[model samples]
Target: MLGNGLLKGLTETARNFFGSYVDKDRLTTIQYPEERAPRIEASRNFPFLVYDGTDPQAGLRCVSCLICEKECPPKCIFIEKSTDKKPDAVGKPQFYPTRFNIDVSVCMSCQICVEVCPFDAIKMDNDFEASATGRFSDLLWTKERLAKSNEYYHHIHPTEAADVDAVLAAARAKAAAPRPPAPSAPGGAPEK
Candidate 1:
């Protein structure tokens, strides 16, 4: 019975080995670099900061909350909040990251950073070729290097991007919606 199971496994391997020659569809191998396979949309590599509009710095969605940095398993992400506030993608004044860095070498690509980001500022990038000659400096990705456009995010993960866009759009609409006037007290004072 033990030998029978081994024989079955060998038979399947042999069948697959011979099938490639007989069946053209069975030949799955492709020439790397020159004829690379199509990228899978759901495949993720590393975390990238997503910006809304044309300006990467101005339109960045990150409010420098430090949630992603704290939640990062490898402690790869580092962030410094700005003193002054600037308008974000939704035109809400927020404190942006003055200094943001991610050590790619230490990162395990677990997508935890992306998951914990409340502002939807971070997303997983499909770029896998982050090779470096030097160990330290090259692997440490600065805010400038990490910032990517929303269009690029959409291009990589269309379905997820579309959903994020819808949610963001709803938030924008809610923020833009005129609110009812605050109730005033009897003696020309605003209600607490």
Candidate 2:
């Protein structure tokens, strides 16, 4: 029965070979570069910053916390907190990054930066076609280049974006709600 396994494998090969004509799914081989396979949602290549509004610089959500930079295993992320203040979506003054860079050549794409980001400012990008002629200069992405709109984030990660939106909405609602006046001192008496 040692040859039985070999025969079974050959049978599968024959079925696939013959089925290529009748079954569209059976044809796995294709002309790449002209026609590419669809990328799955979970596939991660590099980390990118997400912005909330039209202006990438003004709408940036990174509070310059440096959490992602500290957590990155490959030490590919770099950031510099800006001295100037900018109002965020909530109308609070926040410090945006003056210079944020990621070295793609040294980056291992481990998704650790995405995981460690508390602000949800960092997310793994699905783009894999980053070809650079010069490794050091061309491969380095700046803050301007790394920032993508929330819509772009939604386009790339719909499910994750939805979840993040829900959480943000809840937080905004909580922040916007007026706090109930502190209960009057015991027995409806005001204490000095």
Candidate 3:
């Protein structure tokens, strides 16, 4: 009876060996490079920021709030706020960022910058093709490198990007809408 149990196990193994070949046609093992593979949209592997180009400034939505720089675990973000003179006054601190940089080599891509940005100035991009053969300083990304069109964002993550756009549009509409005219006055004559 003990030998009979071993014989049953061997039979099961043999059955499995044959089943593998029998179901080979149903299996999907793509040959790398030779056979192209389809990518699913929900996969998130890279980090990038989305820019709205509608603005005349080429649409850098970051307000230079320094939240991203402060929250960055690695302190990869470098920002330089610009000093602009007021239109009516003589001297004033405009606080517009004249320079912004992110050391991509050190960035962990944790998406924390994207999450903490109150202005939605940053988002995770799907571009994982960044490579360079130079010093660490060479990998430092400037604002120019990070900027990406809003359309590109929608193309990468259509559902999520569209939802965010819809919300933004609604908020803008509410802000732009004029307030209702004052209830006419107490009775008929307009109140001064």
Which residue pairs clash within candidate 2? none
TM-score of 2: 0.80
Better of 1 and 2 by lDDT: 1
Q: Indicate which candidate wins on lDDT.
A: 1
| Model 3 spans > 4 angstroms off | 1-40, 54-57, 85-96, 179-192
User: What's the lDDT for all of these models?
Assistant: 0.91, 0.87, 0.70
lDDT by residue (tens digit), candidate 3, 1-192: 669989999999888788779987745678856875654567654345565655423456666788988999988888876565222111222244567888887888788888898767688776655777877766987777777778877887889888888887787688679977777556687657
Instruction: Point out the worst 10-residue segment of candidate 3 by lDDT.
Output: 85-94
- lDDT string for model 1 (1-192, tens) is 769989999999999989988998888789778887777998998899999889998888999999999999999999999999999876778999999999998999999888888889999998878889989999999999999999999999999999999998898788789987987666877646
Write down the lDDT that model 2 would get: 0.87
For each candidate in turn, the TM-score is 0.79, 0.80, 0.66
lDDT of 2 by residue, 1-192 (tens): 889999999999999888888899877777779998777777888888999978887888899989988988889999998888889866789888889999988889998888888788998899888887886789999988899999988888889999999998898798889987887677867657
lDDT, residue 86, model 2 = 84
Q: Which stretches of candidate 1 lie over 4 Å from their true place?
A: 1-26, 180-192
Provide the clashing-pair count of each candidate structure: 0, 0, 3
How far off is residue 38 in model 2, in Å? 2.3
